[model samples]
Target: MAVAAIAGGTFAFKALDKSVKLVVDGKTQSVSTYASNVEGVLKDANVKVVKRDDLTPKLTAAVADGGTIVLNRARPLAIDIDGVHSKKWVTAYTVEEALSQLGIDGGADVSASRSQRLPLKGASLEVTTPKTVAINVDGQAISVVSTGATVKDVLDAQSISLVEGDFTTPAVDTPVTSGMQVDVTRVRTTTTQEAQPVPYSTSEQPDGTMNKGDKKVVTKGVAGEQVVTYTVTTTNGVVSAKTQVSAQVTVAPVNEVVNVGTKEAPVAAAPAPSGSGAGSSGGGSNAGAIPSSGGLNWPALAQCESSGNPKAVSPAGYMGLYQFDQRTWNANGGSGSPLDASAAQQTAIAQNLYNARGISPWPSCGPKLLS
Candidate 1:
């Protein structure tokens, strides 16, 4: 009986000597034969301790018989929050859980989408707050700004100014967020003047004739003038520039008149016959005394043709009291220059008629015998 009791005791002692296997970061470790939980295994392995250490199955959970223990070492990481960098140690199993433990909420005003995965161990994290702001000037839309600060801070960064008449949607002191919009506008005006050239009237005298330096009222041209109205533009009560919009002529101009004349006189006749017979006494025999028989009345015709003036000329180059052309005078029985008559003009006319027609009658007593 004593021998049987010793064998049973030996079997029980062997079962109690069985040790637990601990696995940490893929590494295997054998714990004390007395280890029966995760805390005992970690204590036996002498693993580093930290504020947010991670353990599989939990620290307070009972250890499985012949099962393994897994421990994850927390790594030191740096974080940059809106340009401010800070160091932190975490081991919450995942990036999201680690951040949560560090007092960072995923639903905060500043957040990152799932696409922006958490950083690796010993990596840095960037936390940003996106802000939106709207700008307006004179009730007009100007610009929209997205930033991570107050409205004034964004405006200063963009080199924008807030004036008396200018305004912001949420007010300059309002906080900024992502997707905010802004607007700005300026009130202005302008002034200007325009000048126009006045037209003048021109007059030309008749061809080959002039007024001989005499001033006439021929279309007296008066100077013309005009005035224009314009709409000026200005900004902030200050005039910028002006332009002419409409124009009109106030008064009409007057035209003057002129007159002209030819300065040359008519040609003179040849000298009369000499002696007493030249002036008078050629009465009843006058008709018969005349030489030419062309049927033309000599005395009455000559007086009428020349208007009783010895000097006369038609525009067609006819000359003398008889108004004889050069060709006709040359064909007569007279001599010397046709235009210059010492006594030749009258004699030429008489001779020409007599030769062309024929003498009708002859006289011996009236106004006679003067060569």
Candidate 2:
């Protein structure tokens, strides 16, 4: 009976004394206690356990031999939700648990990953709740719930496609905000013709046959008309880009060709006497050079008519420097063809004809000899 009492007393003393380890947040401490329960042990260590704090072994449970009691103090975790600053007191182990404990669900996007454990001192996490946004495509508006960060992401999320000549308002690279208005414009191009004036070109050539210092227009230039086809792109009733596709000339341009004379001027002859008379039958062929008669200049008129060549002929079978036909030469007291007569004889006959006819013949080229 004495040995049994001693054994029971030893067992009772061993039960009263327990070895336990306490871990608060990340810190650890050892405590040798005679407390019988977790509450008693917490009382001995001067640790007050609250309902919000986490405990590995519950405070109401009996203390175990060499067992651990982990106390994670509840802390308020800051949350940024839709630009609203909020906080939730939690005792969860990781980011996912914390959100779940706070009644946050519905596949919410957390700035921090779910696997990331809570630190000793809690950190912040951003919760972005997806919202519906309206997108305008080709003047049609459509609404969709999206968690996209940019306009392009939202369009791709909805399986919207974009091709060449397609554009969007607020730009496709811009970040999407809640209730943001997105406009998409479709561009179409067409080939069109526009009439345009084509300028004419000028060309010059040297002409040795024309009189020296003389200018002539070989061909007159005219400005032509042409139609140019352009590839024009229009976006929602607005012009975007234009480029020439093809060109056609309806009226071809005429180039101006001008003749530039390079010929040498003829040398002026000695002035004949103003009173010099034509040869009479009495004086023979040694007649003085006649300059003018009856208010008519003979020498200059003969020069203009036939370039002062006494043996010159006309296309109408006219003869002599005075351009007379055979019948006219005989009527003017000329015996044979005017080509057979000497310059003095031809001049005498021309003077007689001029005196009688009063300079009515040779009107076209004769007026230029007045000066």
TM-scores of all predicted structures: 0.33, 0.44
Question: What tens digits encode model 2's per-residue C-alpha lDDT throughout 154-231?
Answer: 899888888887888888988677888888888888888999999999998999875433456889999999999999
Residue 155 of model 1: what lDDT? 74
Full-model lDDT for every candidate: 0.51, 0.73
Q: In model 1, where do residues sit more than 4 Å from their true spots?
A: 1-14, 17-34, 37-39, 43-47, 51-72, 107-121, 130-371
Clashes of each: 40, 0
| Tens-place lDDT digits, model 1, residues 1-371 | 89999999998877665367777644588775556666766776786545566677777777755867776667676776656689987664455655677877564333434343343356666665444455554445545534445677777877777655455556677656566665444444334445553455656454223212222345666666666667786554556667778877665444444433232212233233221221222221111122222233444333433433233454666554455566666666445443355222453355444445444211322122221
TM for candidate 1 is 0.33
Error of 1 at 337 (Å): 78
lDDT of 1 at 214: 21
